[model samples]
Target chain A: MRLKMDFMGLSLKNPVMVAAGPWSRNPETIMRSLDAGASAVVTETIAMEVRQNVRPWIYSKNEGYQNVRLYSDHALEQWLIFIRQIKKEGGTVIASIMAHSPSEMAYIAKSVYKAGADAIELGLSIPHGEGVAVMGSDPDHMYNSVKRVIQSVDIPVMVKFSPHVTNISELAKVVEKAGASGISAIDTVRSIIGVDLETSKPLLATYGGYSGVPIKPIGLATVASIAQSVKIPVCGIGGISNWSDGLEYMMLGASTIQIGSAIMTLGSEVISDVIEGMDKWLEQKRLRAEGIVGKALSNLKSFDEIEILPYKAVLKDACPESSCETCVVGCLVGALEKKNGNIVYHQELCNGCGLCVSLCKDQNFELKWRL
Target chain B: MNIRDVAQRAGVSVATVSRVLNHPDQVTPKTRERILEIMKAMDYTPNWFARGLNLNRTGVIALLIPNIMNPIYTEIAKGVEEVAHNKGYYTLLCNSEDSKEKEAAYIEMLLHRKVDGLIFIAGHLDPDLMTRIEETRLPAVMIGKIEGNWQFSAVYTDYFEGARKATAHLIENGYSGIAHITGNLRFIESAEKLNGYREALKNADIQINPKWIIGGEETIEGGYLAAKRLVRNPNPPEAIFIANDWMAFGAIDAIKTEGFRIPEDIAVVGFDNNRMSGLVEPKLTTVNLPVYKMGLTASRLLFDEMDTLSSTSESDEKADQKQQIFLPLTIKVRNSCGHQDRIKAIFGE
Candidate 1:
C-alpha cells in the first residue's frame, strides 16, 4: 500500500499528523507523537511572551472539547533550541507561531527556519477566551502576517484560519494570493463552556475554543469550500478521532488531517491506529490513500447551485431485525416515521433535506424524486 | 336572461353556455349547438360582472413585498396568489426591496393602472402613499405590522407575543444578560419586537442594559456585525434574542468566531422560524410566525373592501374604516437556545 503523500512541497509518509496545542507543547511529547506514527508534528503555537492559562483548561462537553485557552506557554527561543534537535532526530518538525506584529511574525519565522524546522505554520486564528491578543480571524491581518512570514522563511509556510468568518473561502483566497504554500483551517470553534448556576460563573471562567468529533462537519465544509476555490494544498485541522475520520477529511479535499482532541482523549496510540486503518481501507477499496484526497470536490456546489429535486424519502422492505434507524428521527422537514413494524415516509412532508439518505448507513431508505 | 338562467334552461354547465357566447371553439360542437339554441330561445347574455370584467374595476391587485428573493415574502405571496386566483383577480407581484422610493413608484404605477385593490407588506407606511390611497379611495390591505396612524386595513402576526415568547424561552433556560438585535426601529414590526424583548426582560427582573439592545439592519450581515459588537463588550451577553432567523445565523456565526460557546457560554433565540432555521449549524431556536396566513387574510380583506367600493359608493362609514388583524405566534425550540440539550444528551450527538 502506497501511503506516502505530498503536502505542499514536502513528502509525508502519511496524511495523519498532530496539530499545535497542549499535545505538542513540549519537545518530549512531540517526539513521542512522531514515534507513535505521526507523519509530521507541528510545535505548540509559540508567541512573543507567555500566555496565562486558567486551571481546568479543557472541558470534554459530551463529544466536544471546549478549551479555555490555547497557544504555548514558552517563547520562540525554547522552540528554536529543540526544533533542530527534533529535526536531527529525523522527525519532521513544523514550527507553529502566533505573534502580534508582522515583523514579529517574520522574525519568529526566520529563527524557526534557521533552527532547521521543516515548515512554518502561522497561527492566525485563536478560538474565543483563548486570545491573549493574536490576530488570525481577520483577512487583512492574516494576509499581512502570512506575507511577512512567507517572505522571511525559505521553507513551506502554512496559515491556520479560524472558522468564525462569514466566508472562509474569501480569507483562503486572500492568503493564497499573499504567498501561502498551504492552508490549515478551523482552528477551533469559539464557544461558551457552560456556566455554574450557584456561583453564576462560566465553567471555564471564560469562553473557550470548542473542538472534537462534533466539529468534523464544520471542518469538512470549510476545507472542501477552500480546496475548490483555491489551488493551494489544504491541511484540515479540526476534529479527527480516528482513521475513518481522517479519511472523511481527505475525501473532502484535505491533503492531511490534524489530530487534536482525539489524541488527548485516546492517547498517542491513536496515530498508529489511524495509519493502520487507512492502509487496510485503502487496500480494501483497491486504491491508494492519495487518490481519495479531494475526490468529493467535483460534486461540491454553492448553496444556490445545489439542484434541489423534489425528492422524498420512502421506506423499502428490508430485514425486520435491521437496526439502522437513521430515518426514524431528526427529520427537520417532518418527512419520515417509524410505523408499526416498518418505516413509513410521508412524500408530501419531506422538504428534500436528504438527511435520511446521508444517515442511513444500511441503505434501508431510498429517495424518490417527484418530477 | 343571464348566462346562469340560460344554462339552467339548456341543461348544461354555466361554463358551457358562457363559452358558447365568449369562445365558441372551447365548447364541443354538440354542446355548443344546444347552448346556442337555448341562448336564442331565452335571449341570454353573459354577465360581465360575474366574469370579473366589471366595467369599473380592473380586477387586478398589486402585492408589494420587501424582497422577492427572501422566502418569507415568497411564502406570503403563495397565500396571496391562492386568494387572488379564487376571486377572479390577477395579481401584480412587486419587489420593493425595503426602499421607500421603489415602493412609492410601485404604488403610483398600480394606481395609474386602476388596480381594483392592493395587498402589500411595507417596511414603513409612507404618509404620501396613504394620502394617495385616501384621495383615490383605492382598496389596500397592509401586511405585517404598521405603526403610523394611517387608516388602512392590515393583517400581521403579533410580533410582540412572538418576541416575548422567544425571550422568555431563553430566560427560562437560565440565560440572563440577554441582548437583542432588532431590525431598524423605524418599522412598526421592529418596534413591536423590541418592546417584546424589553417586556420579557422586565418580567424576568433583569435590568434592561441599554447597551445590549442594538438597532441592526434586517440583513444577515447586519446580525453578524451586531453580534460581533455585542461579543466585544466588557461583559458580553449570556444569550441573544435576534429579531429573525436570518439574523440569528449571522449572530451564531459571529459568536462562534468570537470563541464563545452557544447555550453553554451564551444561548441564542431568533424570531421567524424560516425553513432553513433548523438546518443551520447548532440549529436556531426561533419564534414561528404564520406569514402565509397573514398574506391570505390581507388579500381576502382587500377583496371585501373592493367589493363594497364597486357595489356601493360609500366613501366614508364607521364600519368601513380601516381594520387590524393579529395572528398567534409559536416558539420553536432548537439547538441555539440549548433548550433541547436534554434530548441532545439522551441522543448523545
Candidate 2:
C-alpha cells in the first residue's frame, strides 16, 4: 500500500521533502526536487526588501571566520512567477517567509497564501543578524511573532526552528502553543569551521554557520526530542544526505523530511534516492510512512527513560567468558571477579552505568532499566 | 603642438580656445565650429610628450581590482573614480579575476600605458611582474590585505584581526569545537584569516582538531559542498565558520537540509558583510572591508605621488622604482553570528 505522511492536517504522498535553501530560491529548482520524488518543496525565504552586493566568499585564518554582506529583495513579480510555476508544475510548494517584524511577517504570509502556495513556512530562525535577533532565539519574541503570521493566514503554517537554542523541544512547543500548524525542526547550527593557521584568520568569514554530515546526529536527536515533546507534526530537517538519513527522521516521528545540502551536492536526484530508499525500507519492514512516524519515539520516554546498569555488572559483562576480556582488565571500578574463566557481577557494588556495554563486543551483556 | 600655435592656426584667441576645450557651452556655436574646423584642417595635435617632459607627469593611474564580478570591486572603482576625476588623472581599471596570469597581464598593460601610479586591490604580484614594476619605478599603493614584506604602501582590512574577533565571538558564546570553511590558500588574505582563527583558538585554549578544517572554491556552491562533506563525518564539528557570506549561505542551506538547527546544534558565522547577508532569515555577521575607503585612499596616494613626481625633476634612470601603501578594515556584527539581540534592537548591529 502507498504510504501517506500527515503533518498537522496536511497529507503528503511521502515523507521525503526538499528543505528551503538554494533550491527554494527558484521555482524551477523546487520543481526539480519534487520531480526527483520529494513530497513537497519549501521555497526560499521571502524578505521585505531585497538586498544587494552579497559576495559569497570571505577569509578565515587558523580558527576565525568572517561573513560578507549579500542579499537583496527579489522582485515580487519574479516571486509570483516562481510560485505560479511551481503550482502549474503539479508540485506542492511551501512559501517560506522572513520579515523584519511580526506585522511584516503576517502581511507576507497572507500574500504568499493568496499566491497559490500550498502552505506557508515561517522562518522563525536564521543564522544571520536581523533574522535570529528579531524573530528567533527569544522564546517570547518567536512565539508572538509566529502567532501574528498564524493569525494572518488561513492556510497551514510551518514554523522553521533554529537549532542554536539549548532546548529545541521547548521552542517547538511554544510555536505549537502559538497556533502554528506544524514545525520544521532544526535550522543550520552556528559554528566556526577552523582557521587557516598560516594566515591567523578565519577560513571563510571570521565566522559562519556550519551544516553537513557532522550535523546529522544532532539533527536526528533534535527531531526525536521535538517529535516526542510536541503534538504538532514535525518536519525534520538537517544533514539529510541520503535515504537512510531521511528514514531515521521519519522513525523519530518526522512527518516529512527536508533535504538541502544533499540536493546541493548530489543535485535534485537525491530526492529519488531518499524516496526509493524509504519505500524499500518501509516495504521490507511491512510499515507505511504514517506507521513509521513516531515509531522510534514511542520507545522513547523522558531523559530518565535511559537505563544505567551498575558498574559491577558492566565490568562482569565486559569480561565475558569469550575472548573479549580486555575491558574487564581495564576497568577501574574493580567490580569484576573472575571465576571459572568467567567474570561474575557483584550486585551490591553495581552502578548501572553502561560503560562496559560500550566496551564489550559480545551480545551476552545488556543494560536493562530498573526502578 | 603648443597651445599658442594651435590657437593661431584655428584663428581663435587662446582664451576662446581654452573655453572651447574646457567649457564648449561658453563659446558661440559658429566660433566653436570654425575653431574645430581649423584645428582638424591643421591636424593640430597637442604635444603631450613634451608636456609630460616639462611637467614630469603621466596623467594616468593604474587601478587593480580583485574581480569584476565582485560588487566590492565595483564600489571601490566608484570611489577611485571620484578621487581620480577630481584630481584630473585618468584611472585605468583592470580586473585581475583572482588569477595570477590576469593580474600580470593587467599590470603589464598599465605599465605599457605609462600610468604614473598604481592601486593594487586583492591579488598577488608575480616575481616577474614585481621586477617589471620595480623597473618602471611607478609610485603605487596596495589596497586590501596582503602578506609578506610591505614593499609598498597599502590600504586594507586587518583580516587576521577580523577573523580572530569572529572566532572569539563564537567561542565566547559557549561554542567549544568550531570548524572553518576557507577560501583559496594561495592568497595572503586567506593565510592571514587562517592565522586569526588559530589565534582565537589558542587564546581560548581549545585543542585544534585538524579534521574540521575544509577548504574549497570561494563560491556559494563550493561552500554547500564543503559543508555537506564536513557534516557527514562521524563526529562533525558543532559550529562552523565560513570564509565568505555567499558561501555561508550555501553552508546554511546545506545545514538546514541535513535537518540541523543553526546555533542549536551548530552555529555559523561568515565574512564580507555582503548586502545579502542581512536579507536572509538569519542575517550574516560579517567583516566590513572598507573597500570604498581603500579605493579612495589608494587613489589619493597615487595622486599624491603623481603630484610629487610632477614637481620633482626625475632622471629617466630613477623612473623605474615603485612604492607601496596599506589601509584598514572593520567588522559588521549581524545575526548570522548569533548577534541577533543587538541587531533586533538597532539596525547598525
Candidate 3:
C-alpha cells in the first residue's frame, strides 16, 4: 500500500519533504523538489527585515560553500511570490518564519497563510551566530516565541527545533504546550567546521552551519526523543541523503523526513530516488512508510525507565560457583560485594542507572523493562 | 528593617549607607562596620532598583554578530565572552543577520538596557545608525571589518593582504588561467578578496577572464554550481581559487562528480581553512582569519574604553578614544592546493 502520513491535520502522500534552508528559499526550488517527488517543502526561516542582516560575516565564505544573503528586504513580498509560484505549480508549501518578537512572527505567519501557504513552519531553532547564543538555546524563549506565533496565526503551526540543545524532549514539550500544531525535530546543529591555522580565523563566515552524514545520528536521537515525548507529529530532518535514511527517520517516529544538504549535493533527483527506494524497501518489509511511523517509538524508553540489575547478583550469576572475584574489584558503582561466601546484591540502595553494565565481562547483567 | 531604617539607626545618610553596602572599602571601616552591624541587627535589605538608579550602569555589554550559523562569529563571541566575564561583564549577544536595520535595533535595545559598551561585527552599518552611534558616544568597537573612517575602534584581519598572498602562492606554483569564486562583492572583505585575486592575475601577466569569476551564494551548493559551469567550459582554468573553504569543498565535489581528480586535473584553493578542509580527502589550502583573537581585541578595546570613561572625573568631558587594531593573517599549506607532497618532502623525517 502507498504510504500516507498525517502531520497535525495536514495529509501527506508520503513521509518525505524538503527541510527549510536554501533548498526552500524560493518557489523555483520548491517546485523542483516537488517535481522530484517531495511531499512538501518547508520554506526558509523568515526573520524581520531588521533581523535579516545581523552581520556581514553571515555572507562570509567557507571551504567551498557559499550562501547568498538573498532573503533580505521585502521578505513578505518574496514569500508571496514564492507561494504563488508554488501554488501555480501544484506543490504544497510550508512558510517558515523566524521573528525577533512573537507578535512580529504572528503577523508574518498570517501574511504567509493569506499568501496561500498550506502551513506555517515557525523556525524556533536557527543557529545563526548571535541568534543561537541568545534565542536559539533557551527553552523559555522558544516556548514564548511559539506561543506568540500560534496565537497570531489561524493556520496550522509547526516549530522547527535545533538539535544542539541538551534536552530535545523538554523542548518539544515546551513547543507543544505553547500550542504548536506539530514539531519538526532538528534544525542544523551549531558547529564550527574549524579555523584556518595559517590565517588563524575560521574557515567559513567564521562559524558554519554543520550538516551531513556526520550529524545523522544526533538528528535521529533528537527526533526519536521528541516523538516519544510529545503527541504531536515529528518531521525529522538533517542528513537524509537516501531512502534508507528517510526510512530510519520514519521508524524512529518521524511522520515525515526533510531533504536539504543531500539535495544540494546530489541534486533534486535524489527526492525521486529516495521515494522509489523507500517504496521498494517498504514492500520488502511488508509494511508501508506510514506504518513505520511510531513503530520504534513504542519501544523507545526514557533513560529513567531503564531498570538496572544488581551488580553482585549479575556477577555471581555469570560465574556460578567460580572463585573469579574480578567483577567485584572492576565494579565502579560499588553495587557488588562478597556476602556469605558468594556475591550478593544490595538492591535497596541501587539507583538502577546501569553504570556497571559495561564493566562486567559477561552479558549476564541487563536492564529489565519495568512494568 | 528597610535600608532607610538602617541608615537612621546607624546615624548615617542613605547615600552613605548605600556606599557602605556596595563599595565597602570606599567608606571608613569603622563607619562600614557600624552600618553593617545596624543592618544585621535590623535585618535590613537594600533595594536593587534604587541601587541601579544610583549606579547608572548595568554591568552588561551588547555583542552583535552577523550570523550564528557561522562559527567564526561564535568563536569571536567566545573570546569576547572570556574577557567580558573576567571583567565582570555579561554579554548580550545579538545576531543582526547582516542587516543594517537589525543592527540599529539591537544597538538601541542595548542602549536602552544601558549596556556599558557594544562590540559590533561589521556588516552594512546604515549611515543614520552610524550617526546615532557616534552621537550616543557609547563605547563601541568593530570586529572582522573596518568601515566608514573608523568612527569606532575595530579589530579585523588584513583581508587584502591575506587574499593577495594566497593568490600569489597559487600563481607562483605555475597555475595559469586561475578562476576566482567569491561571495557577494558588496561586503568589504569580499571586495578585498576580489582585488587580491585580480592583482595576483595582473602580476602574473595573465589576462583576466570575466567568465572565470563567478559570484554566487557563499555555500557548498553555490560552489558546486559555479564549479559545474567553470569545468564545463571548452577550456576551463587550470586552477581555481575560491574565496571560502565551504565553496571550495562544493567545487571539489562538483569536480569529482565530473570525474576529474583534484590538483591533477585542476588545482583548487579555498579561503578560511575551515575545520573540514584538512579532514577532507585532498585537504584544503586556504587563508586563516583569526576570529577568536579579533573578538578578544574588539572586546578588550570596548572594556578599556569603558574603564577610561568610568575612571575619568565626571567634569572631564573629553576622553581619549581607543584606536583600531588590525591582526595579521598567514596561509596554511595543505594538500588541496598541491602542496601536500612538497611540504612532506621538505619536512621529511
The sequence of per-residue lDDT tens digits that candidate 2 reaches over residues A178-283 is 9988888777665656667999865554234556567778788888888878888888888888888888888898888898766656777888987888888888
Number of backbone clashes in candidate 1: 11
Poorest lDDT segment (10 consecutive residues) of candidate 1 chain B: B340-349
Give TM-scores of chain A for all candidates: 0.90, 0.80, 0.76
Give the CAPRI class of candidate 3. incorrect
For model 3, the superposed segments whose C-alpha errors exceed 4 Å read A50-74, A132-134, A301-371, B1-349
User: Candidate 2, DockQ to 2 decimals?
Assistant: 0.01
For every model shown, what is its TM-score relative to the native structure?
A: 0.49, 0.47, 0.43
Question: What lDDT score goes with residue A313 in model 1?
Answer: 70
TM-score of chain B of each: 0.79, 0.77, 0.81
TM-score of chain B of 1: 0.79
Q: Model 2: per-residue lDDT, tens digit, B1-349? A: 6568778887668988765554343354567778877777778765667756655556677777777766667878877876676444677788777778898778878877677788775456665676677567678776764545545555556788878877887887788889998887887777778888889999999998988888978888988999998888899888887887778888988988998877678788887776677787666667666566556656655654554555456643143333332333345666555553553323333
How many clashes (backbone N, Cα, C below 3 Å) per candidate? 11, 173, 53
List ranges where model 1 is wrong by over 4 Å.
Answer: A129-134, A303-305, A308-310, A318-352, A356-363, A369-371, B1-349
> Which one wins on TM-score?
1
Off by over 4 Å in 2: A57-73, A131-134, A303-371, B1-349
